[model samples]
Target: MLILECPYCGVAADETELSPGGEAHLVRQGPGSSDQELESYLFGRKNPKGVHFERWRHSYGCGKWFHAARCTMTLEVFATYSAQTPVPPKNVINAIKAKRPDWEGWT
Candidate 1:
């Protein structure tokens, strides 16, 4: 079972207690954006087999949202951080690197 610790509430919650919010740190397309940009933003998502960053909402617990760095293939959670973070923190990146030396890193 997939489990993640809520950074806000510090609760280790299972997947059932949380809500997956798709890929994290997406560049949102807004008004004045071209059709291609909008379409790409909506559909051009990376379904990588390795390290992935994603958003999660602790619905059954504190009801707060956060971001998590994890391995999609092994389900190994590297770290969790605030959703407001624009990019993965240094520690989280280092953690991923320590485990996955060849990880291309966040784009």
Candidate 2:
């Protein structure tokens, strides 16, 4: 089973103890946005094949949300970080690069 570390609570939680919160770092469309923009925000997802970032909540532990950088094909977790930011931090990016030398980068 997959294991994820919760940054907030410092707990290494098993996959069964967590809940997937979908792709992370998505920009939310608000009131002044067009219908298409709002629609895309509501449903559109890149769903890429390689390196991906996602949100994971420690459902059975601290009940906090965190971000995880992982490989979609291999299901290899590179790193996990706090969910308060809009983008992956530099350390997380570096960790991914160390693990995956061919990574094209994420932004």
Best model number under TM-score? 1
Superposition error at 67 for model 2 (Å)? 0.7
Write the residue-wise lDDT of candidate 1 on 10-53 in tens digits: 99999999999999999999899999999999999988998999
Which candidate number would show the highest lDDT if scored against the true structure? 1
TM value for model 1 = 0.96
How far is each candidate from the true structure, as Cα RMSD in Å? Answer: 0.8, 1.1
Model 2 C-alpha lDDT per residue in residues 1-107, reported as the tens digit of each score = 78888999888899999999999999999999999999999999979898999999999988999999988988888999999999999999999999989888986
Which residue runs of candidate 2 sit more than 4 Å off their true CA positions? Answer: none
| Superposition error at 13 for model 1 (Å) | 0.4
Q: CA lDDT, every prediction?
A: 0.94, 0.92
